[model samples]
Target: MIERFYLKEFLTFKEADLEFHPGLVVFTGPSGSGKSILMRSILASVGLDSVEAQICESSVTWMIDEERYGLQNESLNTFRHVKKEKTRYFINNQSTSKSSMESISSTYLRHLSLKDYSDFDPSAILKIIDERISARSPQYAGILENHRVKFAEFKILSDQLRSIEEKEKHLSELKEFALYEIGKIDAIKPTVGEDEELNLIKKQLSKKEKIETVIAQAQGIFSFESHVSSALGMLEVDSAFFDDAMNELHSIIESSLERMEELEEVSVESVLDRIEQISELKRRYGSVEEALEYRKQKALELESYETMEHSKSDLIKQISAIKAILETSAKELSLKRHAILGETLEKLNGYLGMLYLREATLNLEPCELNASGEDKAVLGLAGTKLDKLSSGEFNRLRLALLALGVESMNGGGGVLMLDEIDANLSGEESMSVAKVLRHLSSRYQIFVISHQPQLTSMGQQHFLIYKDDESRVRELDDAERIDEIARIISGDSVSEEARGFARDLFERARGL
Candidate 1:
C-alpha cells in the first residue's frame, strides 16, 4: 500500500502532501479540478506514468528484493521521480533507471486504466479452470501432471525429429564434404619424420661431390703409411702405436667410400619431390600427425552419413509414438476443460450482473499442443468483443474478471489504480460498481476517480479536490464528506434533501 504521496509544481496543483490507508480511496471534485492530474502524478512517482511534476514521490510498504535490485529496503520504501531537464528515478535515494524502478513497482501495482488483455490470456484462464477441475476431482491433478510430463517428452522428441529433418535436407552436401576432406588427405600418404630423412639425404647430395674429391686426394697418404712407420722405428718411437694409427686411418677411408657408394642408389629428383610434397602437407595441416588425425575424424563422420537414414527412421518412430500419446492426453484435457468452461462463465456473469453490464462468454478451441495444454480459451461479450466495449463497460468487465481471481489470493494482492470507473453511469449502476469495488478493496488498495454521489459516498477515504485560487485537495471529514457528496448530487447549490441522502448513503455503506 502507498503510505504517503507528495507532488509539487505539477500542471495545476503547486504542492500536495497526502497520507493514505488500505481500502477504497475515492477522489472527486468538479470537472477540471486536477483530479486526473493528481492520479497521474501518483502513478508517475512509481514509474508507471509520464508526468512533468518537479518532484513526485510515493512512500509504499512494498518490501523490494534488496539483493536482487541491489538497493536497501527501508521499512517504507520511497519511489521518487524527479523531473529536471530530464527525468530521473530513485529508490531509497539510490539512483536507478526508469525501467528498473518500473519493474520493481509493477509487481505491487497494476494500473487498469487501459484495455488490458492479461486477464484473458489462455494460460491464465486454463490455470484457473484446471484448479477448479482439480478441486472437484482430486485424481485430476495426477492426470494433469501426467499430461504435462508427456508434453515435455513430446517437445524433446519433436525437436530431435526437426533436427534430423534439417540434417537430412543437406545430407548430400555433407556427405560430399566429408568424402572430399578424407580423399584430399589420403592422396598424400606422407609418413612422420619422412620429410626430415629426405631433407637430410638432399643435404648429403648437395656436398657429395666436394667430399668425394677431397677423399680421393686424401687417399694418396695411405702409400706413405709404411714409410712413416719405419721412420718412427728409426727414431726409436713406438712402432705399435704408429701401426695402430695407420690401420685406423685406412678404415676411415674405406667407410667413406662405402657411404659414397650407397648414394648411387638415391635419386635426387625423387628425394626433392618427396620433400616438396611433405612441405606442402606441413603448410596445410601444421604437421603430418594433425593431418592423419583429421582423416580419422572424417572417416567416422562419413560412416555416420552412410547410416543416417537408419537413425532418422528410428527417431521418426519414437516421435510418432510420443505424439500419439500426447494427442490422447490432449483430448482428455479438452473434454474436462469443456466441462469447466460453463462454470467459469457463470461466475464471471454473476459479477457482471452486479456491475450492470452484459453477460460475458468464454469458448475453448483446439490448438497445437504446448506446455499449457491444447486449449485456446477466448473470452468475449455476448454480442461484441472485449475491445469493442465502451470504456466504462470495459473497465467494469475487467473488474469482474479480476474478481474471479480474488478468491484464490491468499493475502494482499496488490494496488489497483483506475480512471473514472463510474463515469456515464446511472445512479443504480454507479452504486453497483461501487459495491463491487468496495469488496475488491478488501484484497487490493483501490484508487479511483468519481463524479457521482453514490460512488463518492461509498469511499472508505474520500478526498475533495477543488479550485481555490489553485487546485487543492483535502481529506473530507464526516460533515465535509456529506457536503461534497451533496455538491456532486445537486451541483454548487446543494439542496437539503441531497445532504440528507448523502449522509444516509455513507452511513449505510459503512453499516453504521
Candidate 2:
C-alpha cells in the first residue's frame, strides 16, 4: 500500500504531504480546489501521465510487507522522484526504472474503480475464472504455454509459405537467368596457370633478337682470333725462352675455336614454340584467371537451381504440418475455455445483485485465431448491452465486479484507487456503492475521490483538499476535516443543520 505521498510545484499544490492508512481513504473538497490536481500529481509521480511536466520536486514512498501474503524475506520500500524530465524510481534504495517499479507495485496495488469494470474485459474475466478452476489442476499453465508456442510456430511457417507462393510465378524466370549465366562460362573452357605461362612466353619472344645478337658478338670475338695466333708464332723466335709461353697460347686459341662453332649452331625453334603458345592463350581465354573464375561461378549457379525445387517442396510440407498442429491445439483450448464459461457467468451474476437486471456472458464465436483465444465477452442487462447502460448503472455494475473480485482474491487484495466514482449516482445507488466500497476496504486498501456524502462518510481516513488564502492547495486533517465536510454539506453557507448532518454522518461511519 502507498504509505505517504508528497507533492511540490505541481499545478495548484505548491507543496503538500499526506499519509494514508489501510481501508478506505477518501479525498473530498469543493470544486476547483485542487482535488483532481492532487490525484493527477499522484498519478504523475507513478509515471502514469503524459503531461511531460517535471515533478518540480516531490517524493512518494510505499511500504510493502510481502510476508502477509506468504512471500519470504521480502520487506521493502518503493519510492519515486519527480525532479527532472525522467522520473527516477527506487526500490529498497536501489535505483530502478519506472516500468520495474510499476510492475512490482501492481502486484501489491490492484487499483479497481468504477471506471474499469473487470467484467467488461473478456480476457481479465477469463483469467480470474481460469485461476479459480485451474487451482485444482496444476497442468493448466503448461497446457496454455504449449499451445502458445505451437500457435506462434504455425504463424511463422504460414507466413513463409505465403511469401514463397507469391514468388513462385517468378521462379521459372530466375531459373532461366541462372542457366544462361552458367552456359556462357562453360563454353569458354578456360584453364588456370595459362595466364602466367603466356606471360613468360611473350617475354621470351620479345627479347629473342637481343639474346641472339649477344651470342653473335661473342662468336665474332673468338672467330677473328687468327691474327693473334700469327703474332704469337713470330714471338717464338726466342726459341728456348719463349717455348713454354707459345704452347700455352696455342692451347687457348684451339679451345676458343671449338666454343665459337658451338655458339653458331644455337636453335630458334624454342622461341617460335613459346610465341605460338601465348597467341593461342590470348585467342581462347583473353585472360586465364578471368576464365577460371567464370567456371566456378557457373558451377555454383547450376547447383543452386538444381536444389530449388526440392527446397520449395520441403517448405510447403512444413507449413502444412504446422497449420494442422495449430488447429488441433486451438480446438483443445477453445473446448476447455468454453467448458468454464458457464461457471464464470454464475459467479459474475451472483456478485452483481440480480436486481440490476444484468446478465454477463462469454461467447466463444469463431474468429481468426491469434495469440489470444477466439472468444469475446458480451455484457447485457435486461437484453441491453453494457455499452448502452446509463452512466449511473455503469458505475454500479463496475462496483459489483470489484466486490466480487475482492471476495475471490486468495490473500489480502490490492490497493484500489477510484476517481469520481460516485458521480451521477442516485441517493439509493450512492448508498449501495458506499456499502460495497466499505466491504471491499476490508480486503483492499481503497482510495476514493468522491463528492458524495455517502462515500466521504465511508472513509476510514478522511482527507480534505482545499485552497488556503494564498491559493495553494493543501491536505487538511482533524478539525479541518470536520469543517471541510461540513462545508461540503452546507456549500458556501455552513448552517447548524449542515454541521449536525456532517457530524451524524461521521458518527455513523465511525460506528460501521
Structural similarity to truth (TM-score) of each candidate: 0.73, 0.60
Best by the TM-score measure: 1
Backbone clash total for model 1 is 0
Pairs of residues clashing in candidate 1: none
lDDT of each: 0.87, 0.64
Stretches of candidate 2 off by over 4 Å are 50-125, 177-336, 354-357, 370-374, 381-417, 438-446, 471-487, 490-512
lDDT of 2 by residue, 220-335 (tens): 65554556566667875434444555566557655655545544564446545644554564565576665556557766766765775676788778867866766776676677
Best by lDDT: 1
Candidate 2: give the clashing pairs.
none
Ten contiguous residues with the weakest lDDT in model 1: 401-410
How many Å off is the CA of 455 in candidate 1? 1.9
The per-prediction tally of clashing pairs is 0, 0
